[model samples]
Target: MSDSLERDALKEILTASIKEQRAARRWGIFFKVLTFGYLGLVMALMLGWIGAHESESASSGPHVGVVDLSGPIAADGDASSQLVIAGLKAAFEDKNTKAVILRANSPGGSPVQSGMMYDEIKRLKAKHSNTPFYVVVEDVCASGCYYAAVAGEKIFADKASIVGSIGVLMDGFGFTGAMDKLGVERRLITAGANKGFLDPFSPQSEEQKQKATAMLQEVHQQFINVVKEGRGKRLAADNPDLFSGLVWSGESGLKLGLVDALGSVDSVARDVVKVDNIVDFTPQPSYADRLARQLGVAAATTLGAKLEWQLR
Candidate 1:
């Protein structure tokens, strides 16, 4: 009887131990999964997943709706025309919005993107005539950025801010000399005569150069015309280089009529918009968008190698 009792006690203890181990494992897995989820949420919030939702305000009182136009303006870039247009639409459509402020700080990029944004802003203004639009420049607003800024009713900038670079450029490099030193021969094949016109690995052609220059000049002329139409009589006709792809300080720009006044976002929001409260309406890129863009870049980089042979 004693031996049987001892055997039963041992069996019960073993079963309880097994049960405890399974419970411990379950809790451990649950906590680890919870930790990983928390980390992912924090990372997403830091990367602007949450900020995108806060772009517009649910205000009932009059306030200035601000939209940031920072960094290079391009179709694939953060300052894309689509994002800007969406933000502008929201700001204009907001019932409590007194005025819209375009706060720009960039060295400019992609004339096509700038032109699209400029046209869209004009369309929005025409549709919403009551909501006044003003541009406030910080640091630099040159080339394409200036093109978009002029669409505003008035442009304000700090005294030391750099503004204006009304021009177009197509830049590249020639590696023929280096290739010759490295004993590399380029074997370029093309079906069309002008298909390889600007290939840097080949010899430069006088006719091609002339054609490229003319094309650039035409683009530059278009930029000049846009500035002229936007600034109108406010531009200083005395400065010959006003549209010569030259930049100037904000204070000098005021004298040269590149800028209307010297002020900042706060000042413009308060004095021009007649509201001290400024709500940002810049469209924030979500984490998924950012991830997709990164994936696109990776794919492009892989394809870039395949196109390396076209350099010839």
Candidate 2:
């Protein structure tokens, strides 16, 4: 009876050990798969395979390289200079590309980001003298969008498309009234007098307002200079509201010299570039990169909600 009991006990221990080893092996396989997936995602992003819009079909002959300029032109916006510049560079570097087209569709955002892209386009133009760059406004290209548009050799749009808002503005909210209604008092401290110049919780300061207006005027002037330099002798010199932060239809824009003509992406590619095939070279963010950026944007927006300051 004792011998039989010992045999049974040893068998049970062996069975439990086997089960534990099997579970360990399963977990090890699961972790390896997870790690491989993560590494593959990283590789795809580094190779510019994911999030990027590639050509639909392969072309043997000359093609018109197109890049999209959609959404706001802010640093954290979809149409940021970093992505646009990368797309433009890729399009320009392609030997089979006869010309480059920037299909702009935006309400404008940041002037600084726009300026950076403008500089890059100009540099690329000089480097590739044979390849011409053009802008085709789809919906709207106002303020900063127009700033970047001017860098192109020609700007086109549909007859109904909105174009041009050549100006700068700084805007904010005054929460003092709201706070007073709610019986809440704000206590903000600063080291420099001008540091809290535009704080919403504080009373409005005439000096700060004037300073802000003057700064906007300076930026507006810079915008005007770029338009003049790019349009060069094309803009209607007699129109007083050309730089007055006013927008116009494509038809009016054509007459005002804001747009060269009424055209679309297809038309430009076919008639101007003389090619039917349009290859979009927009650098799409990888899934992981996009997820990371989205999270960052959410965090920024949440933080910004605490303040009431916005610039245009």
Candidate 3:
């Protein structure tokens, strides 16, 4: 009889535990629903606020073209030529826009990408001769970045900012010795004799070295020509090493005639542009987009947890 009573007690405990788990699960579902609902409401409110702000600003005053050239200036990067050109076009089309500002923060990337943007900026400026375009360098603007900057009517920078790395670079690794040591076979074929000149797995020939040097020299000359065209009479021709892939601080850059003035974005906007109010024309990711991204991450985490739980 005592054993029977113990079994009944054990069964009752198990049943009560199951009930508790069920209740907990219900609460969990409720909390998740509430959390998602709250996020949705917040997103709606943010969108409303942004729309209202845009409307109010549009009604109030003239717009300024503000294009953010952040990150490496590559065709594949966020600071792509297409995106920058689109922003510039939008600014140009805006009847209330007085001037265009290229806010640059980049170390640099593809020379081709930078050249494309520079040409576009110059063409646009020429097309809209009445509108002035200014460049404000932030943090670091070097190499291809400075190339684009010279397209601006005036260039401004912070005193300590890094500017000017006026040169081109092609990086590669040679692993012929390492591959030989490891008994690895390199299987590479090219149509042209000099096509694989910079191949790492193969031994470099004297002819290849000469060819590569000549190619780099040609590219360097092109870079120097672009700089000359952009800077015009401002750049001192005395410094032979100006285009030798060297960087300089904002102070030295100013002395070298790389930058026009030393000032922060706020100072330029308030003092130089002579407008107290400013509108950011740079496309910012919306809050809803950010929230959706966060939610996607959270969902992925939850899915991963579920998979782990199932595996366990």
Candidate 4:
């Protein structure tokens, strides 16, 4: 009886060990699969394969396409013309896009970038005449942001949204006084007569200042012409402050014919486009791209090389 009892005890121990080993193997497999899935997701995000408009497809049915334009627009920024234009192209080319809306919230940026976007919007609008293009402003759409907004068929904004800064300025620091007090002299040699124009450490030149002022005026006139061509008779031409570089509330902008009416993106999509479903077509930069851009900017700053000499 003692032998039989010992044998039974041994058999039970063997069964328990087998069960434990099987469970450990199963758990190991589960953990390995979970880790791989997580890594895949991270890779997809880093490659921009899964982003704002990842779900864009024909099966989505009819929807309003939205392209976001926010922050300071620049060649190396998220709101650059290249990205914005890419979004616009995608939105226009999509068969299910009932309309395209540019959701803007920017204090403006590079005029060149803004102009490229504006021209693309116009081109897209003409190509997709059946699909209406609109601009919905949030926060402030002044300066370069407004420059692009004018290309839209209609401009919508909240009553309190800030709009319009129809002017140009060349702003810089003059460190000559501080340098003089510090007994530091700057020695800059250039082959061109105006090569050292607007040097902060050098003495101010009246001729250079006049030239800068004239250039600003010319750009300002170009901005004014674009606005006039866009707004046409709707603009309140009698308003002296219309192009005076002053920002105004959306309510005041309506009076000046700067904005068509007060509305939001949702309201426009629902009421105007007759589509409640909206898909973002804005191209979000991948993590790798963003990191590269940041590195480039850092290098430029360290080298004291200005990426853009002019800002809108």
Pairs that collide, model 3: none
What TM-score should be assigned to candidate 4?
A: 0.82
Ordered from best to worst lDDT, the candidate numbers read: 4, 2, 1, 3
* Regions of candidate 3 where Cα sits further than 4 Å from its true position: 1-57, 284-312
Query: What lDDT tens digits, residue by residue, belong to model 3 across residues 152-232?
Result: 888899889888877765555678899999999989888987666667678877887686668667866777888888888
- lDDT agreement with native, every candidate: 0.82, 0.83, 0.74, 0.85
Tens-digit lDDT track of model 4 for 168-287: 776667788898899998999889898887777788899988987897788788889889988888899788988888889999999899999999999999999899999889888888
Best by TM-score: 1
Clashing pairs in 4: none
Best by lDDT: 4
- In model 4, what lDDT does residue 213 have? 81
lDDT of 1: 0.82
Name the TM-score of candidate 2: 0.80
Clashes of each: 0, 1, 0, 0
Alpha-carbon TM-score of each model against the true structure? 0.89, 0.80, 0.73, 0.82
All predictions: root-mean-square deviation over Cα? 4.8, 5.1, 11.2, 4.8
- Candidate 1: residue pairs that collide: none
Cα shift from native, residue 68, model 4 (Å): 0.5
